[model samples]
Target: MHYCPYCGSLVIEEEKYCMKCGKELPSDFDERVTSSKSKWKWWKYPIIISLVIALFITVLFVRTQQQENDAQELYQQAEEMALIGDYQTSKEYIEQALDHKNNFPTAKAVLDFLKIAIESKNTINDIDALAKNQNYEEALDKLTAIENNISGFKGDLINKLNTTVSDYRNNILYQQAEHKLTNDLSKDELKELLWEVEEITDEKAEVIKEAIQEKIVAHTSNHATELLKENQFNQAMLVVEDGLIYAEESEQLQSLKTTVEKEKIAFETAQEERIEQALTIYEQEDEINRNQAVEVLNVNASVSTNEITVTGEIKSVATVPINSILVSYQLKNNDTQILENDVYVFPETLYPDEKGKFEFTHFNKEIKNNDLTAEVTKITWFID
Candidate 1:
């Protein structure tokens, strides 16, 4: 790679002149070309063919030298035009110089500066046109394009443009909400939109919230108006209460409440119509279901030991699946006659089937005789 002598940009060696700067060929260039072709000169060819090749090489070399001269002349002209601030003319000449050698690095640098200047001018014009038409959306778009294209604009200008766009968007949302609130939509729909408005920020959200509150008050006030026209004082009071809930601390809510109270005195005497009655009817329906439960009975009296074990199969009215049944027995004296005992027994929440076994030990030490009887009060099933 070779750099442009004028602007210090990279250029390819194949070029005859600087594509960017339009600079002339270097004066001591015979040494550079001879060095390039010296490697292949040793191969021999016919004299006529050699002469024709020599003529073609000479023509090619002259054309390359002429192009270098033309590019240098164009560079001088472009520079003068730019110095006088005739950028449009300068841009055209620079383009023509680049056509001779696209790898001119000097011309590319100047083109970069000119392109930025042109873009800035066009952006300002677009912004002006959009502002005149009150097309805020398009104005924002133009400002953003300028910001992306140019790098050296003043900071304050960018900040001002951003503020303008933010305000425009917020105002658009506020106005949309105002229009919706004014229409006769249901309260549920209005409340839902009100929540969305709160999600918006800055001036727009505040404005919309105020508008929604006003609509709520006005709609509730309509209820008051209807109640007065029909002379339904109690129903009107309910409507005023509902309005108070919707409006909260609004002036509309206060005035509505006062107006209903003022009409309360005269409206009180007009409510005296009553219809009262009481009626009763007794009806019965009967249903029967098969009832099944386990029963455990102890069959021996006067067992010889203080400890006695009772074992029995529980009988059920239907095919009884015998499960583990709780046998609760209190040893009583043989002389004590057995009567129907109502004992509260804790039944297992689940039913279990097994050989149910429960042992009753007589704990009282005073009974000298070993005569003992066991009684079954309740039976319950537990599953393991």
Candidate 2:
């Protein structure tokens, strides 16, 4: 038997080459093959060791790349979640990324940022809860604190929270105003409530203010109308005036005030004219004699701090006895404006040429040195 020198394969002694490895045998085949095998054994160990080390390096590189890819994917997921305001879930993803690559700098920074974001999200949620619970002042305080402290924090979440707080506050104010309106508040109280309602800068705030204004105007108008019916013109004007302070542009109240003023002027003018006509009739001697009425004489007026008193004498000039006689008197100011007018009645019968005493008293503070006039407005004769 022989072995090829180049390859460790057995062959017949007559063969020139080994068929298995296709290597030719050397002369002095056994010694050459032995020397060749021994020399190549050390070379095979080095090549095998080199091949094993290269395979290990390649596997390690592939695994490291896969881990890096996983970490990057987690970071991207964290970023997406953070964009959607899911800070808690984003923080979890970022922490997982850090786990994959413990020393990743970008992941570290993102984790820090996510931590802040989570805190802000939690704070906003707490504020929402507080507002829902109607603890609006506290919620506002917390929100303001966050706004003052956190720079560049005006994102969608913060904006939404601010709007929510604002709406809630306005809603509270509107409800309070509505409640106040339900009560029978005075015009001044309603005015103050309107002021408060106007301070609310919400969409519904205008509606609330308009409703309050309507209530004020309606109430004032109705009250003034009642007063006008009772001839309390001064008090009615005061009510309308107060209502105008709340509803400055209310046409209803303005019209009511104008009507009151006009009626008051007409009433005063008519009274003055009636008094003047009564005085004219009394002054005409033929008219008095034709009517066979009473004559007013010895008229005098006395004034005091709070009142004016007018005393006069009336003589029945009728042919027969009169059962009743009535005298009307007018108190005039310096401008000839009638301050007051009243009638004095004598119920007892007065025969011809019989005299009767009449007096008129009024609480008129403005009754100064002015003319006084009296006339017999009525005479009743007894039927025989």
Predicted structure with the largest TM-score when compared to the true one: 2
lDDT of the structure predicted as candidate 2 = 0.72
Off by over 4 Å in 1: 1-172, 181-188, 270-384
lDDT by residue for model 1 (114-161), tens: 576456556666766666556655665665665666445333333444
Clashing pairs in 2: none
Which ranges of candidate 2 are over 4 A from the true structure? 1-158, 229-235, 248-251, 274-384
lDDT of 2 by residue, 215-236 (tens): 8998899899999998788999
TM-score of every candidate relative to the true structure = 0.26, 0.41
Among the numbered candidates, top lDDT falls to 2
Measured with C-alpha atoms, the lDDT of residue 139 in candidate 1 is: 65
RMSD of each: 28.4, 18.5
* Residue 77's lDDT in candidate 2: 92
